[model samples]
Target: MSVLVYTENWDGRFKKLSNELVSYGSKLAEMLNTSTTVLSIGKVDEAELKSLGKYGADKIITVTDEKLATLDNRAYTAVIAQVVEKEKSGIVLLSNNNTGKAIAPRLSVKLKAGIASGITAVPEKTSPFTAAKKVFSGKAFAKFVIKTDIKILTLAQNSYEIVEKTGQAAIESFSPSVSNDLIRTKVINVEKQTGKVLLTDAEIVVSGGRGMKSPDNWGKIEELADLLGGATACSRPVSDEGWRPHEEHTGQTGKIIAPNLYIAFGISGAIQHLAGVSSSKFIVAVNTDKDAPIFEAADYGIVGDALQVLPKFVDAVKELKSL
Candidate 1:
């Protein structure tokens, strides 16, 4: 049984998340003593598809159908399930993003595969097929043992390193029969957000909380994010109060992000907020209270009024850039 990675493309192009999945799949293939095969479903270009080899993909399969461009849970699940069977893949990998979360359950049901969702690492040992993921909202870890012949795993983002290996993948075209009845979702129009970093894709994220005092005080927060070329996020309360858009909310009840660097200003670091960003590589917190919960998790912390400290932080970044 080989390893298969179901990579979802964005606008006919792959994202860094896709490469990360390929990298993880390649590692799993090595552990399983098999080859790596990637299935790309959408109207994607050949050149872009082959680029996955840099991350250790052995073979690339493309299913070019205009109807499959948009994600329909039923349709995409069928397509991936079909590929898994055709390749005789024992382990199927996907990202824990919106698309992955949407289709993983359906694919699991269709393939009768045991699913380990939101896993942060590869199998500790594949003997009994032992895999571990964060449990209880990242407060702890739990290991799962699957006896099923087929295993489906959805990996958490930013958890695996993307490694490059020498190989030029052989490309193959796949045309799976997608029943029209399975394509139930219809797209009317797409409103694209332009000229800002996407929170999910950002390496660095600057966030503000209710401690910012007023919505008018967010200028410095946005400026800091812009200076660092990162995305802007907020606590859930900030979103609920309409101080910021709901899309910027990051928490257990909202978006879960694990950026390389997460900076929190005016956020008190409630457990709910920590649940979302606890996985960040580096956390920088600035709050007035020294006993704020954020400091416990922060790699670097400044205890002072966030409003007072923000201007200084902005100036420091500007000075460093000018130098």
Candidate 2:
């Protein structure tokens, strides 16, 4: 049996998470002494599909259906299940992002496979197939083992490294036994936030909080993010105040992120907010309050007003770059 990874794409381009899945799955396949295959849906470029070979996919399966372009959880689950059975894949891997979170549970039920969601590492022990996962919003780690013959896993974003290998994956066309009737929901229109790094895929993130006082003051945060080529995020209160979009909110109740570097501006760290970003590799907190809870979680803490400090910090970065 081969290892099957669901490499998702949007607007004809593969996401960075998709490449990580391929890399993770391929390494796992090597450990299992099996081949790795990637299953993709929608209209992705043939060259892009074949390029997954460098990340360890031995074969790429593309299902080009107009109806499949819009994400219908039920329809996508059905297609994935069909592919798993056809490939006789014993292990299935998916990103634990929005789409995977939506479809994984449904697909697990359809395949009668034991699923482990939000796993942070590869299987620690292959014999028992134990995988490590983060729990309590990144506060704790737990090991989970799937007893079912067919195992499904949803990998946490940015947890695995992408290693390039030399190989050319063969691209094959796949038509799953999917019908239009299976699509219970239809997407009428799509509005996308364009020209910014998706938070989940960003290595560095610059975030602000209610301490920014108003949406008009977000310029500094955006400038920092732009300089670093990173994404901009906000705490939940900022989103609640409508100062920022909900998608940019990161906290226990919002999107969980684990970027390489997380810079917090004017954010007093609540446990909920920390829970969301505690997994970040390095955290820098800039707040006027020295006792801000965020400072306790930050690797480097600066007790100062963000509004006053941010401009100087940006100027320093610019000066360093020029030198």
Candidate 3:
């Protein structure tokens, strides 16, 4: 049995998370002494399928139909389940995105495989097949072992490194049994966000809180993010206050991110917010409160007013870049 990665894409282009999944899938396949196969649904082009080789997919399986252009939880789940069964895949890899979140649980029951979501690390050994996963929203780590022959794993976004392999793989076309009536989810419109990197996949994130005072004051945060080529995020109160969209909010109740660097300005670092971003590699907190809870999790802490500190920090960054 081989490892299978459910490669997710939008508008026929591969999403960044697909490479991260394939990276881990390829390593896992090597450990198991098997090849990694990538399974794509919908009408993705052949050239794009061959590019999977750069991300460690030994073979690409394209399952296409007109009905699959848009995501339908029921239809997609049925098709993926059929593929896993047909291939007798031992480990099924998935991205922990909207699509993977919708289909993983359903596919688990269909395949009778154990599932571990938000996984952070690869398997340590082979006999028991254990994988390390983050628990309590990044506060803790736990190990899970699959007793069944089939195993399903939904990896956290940006959790694994994308390993590149040279050479292309031959794309194989497949006609999976599908029901058009069941795949009734239709896409009416698509709205793309402008000028902001996605927070979930961003390596560096600069965030502000209610202390930013007003929406007009967001320029400093934006400038810092732009200079670093990263994303801008905000705390819950800022989103609730309508200074930013709810999508940019990060906290226990909001989206979770594990960027390489997380910079917090004026954020008090409530336990809930910390729970979401505690996985960041380095945390730098800038707040007036010397005893703010955020300082506890921050690798570096600066106690000062954000309004005074922000502009200076941005200027210093610009000056350093110029030098």
Best by TM-score: 1
What is the model-wide C-alpha lDDT for candidate 3?
0.87
List the candidates' TM-scores in order.
Answer: 0.98, 0.96, 0.95
What's the number of clashes in each of the models?
Answer: 0, 0, 0
Query: Which ten residues in a row are the worst by lDDT in model 1?
Result: 63-72
lDDT of 3 by residue, 54-162 (tens): 8888889998776787788888888888888777799999988878899998888988888987787788766787888878777788888877788899999877877
The candidate that achieves the highest lDDT relative to the unseen native structure = 1
Query: Distance (Å) between predicted and true CA of 24, model 1?
Result: 0.5
Ranking by lDDT: 1, 2, 3
TM-score of 3: 0.95
lDDT of 2 by residue, 1-323 (tens): 89999977877898778889999999999999999999999888888888899998999999997788888999999999989989999999999999899999998999999999998888999878899888888778889989999999999999888899998899999877778788888778878879988898999999999888899999888988999999999999999989999999999989899999999999999999999999899999999999989999999988998888899989998998893
lDDT of 1 at 100: 92
Q: Model 3, stretches more than 4 Å misplaced?
A: none
- lDDT of every model, 2 decimals: 0.92, 0.91, 0.87
Which residues of candidate 2, in runs, are more than 4 Å off? none
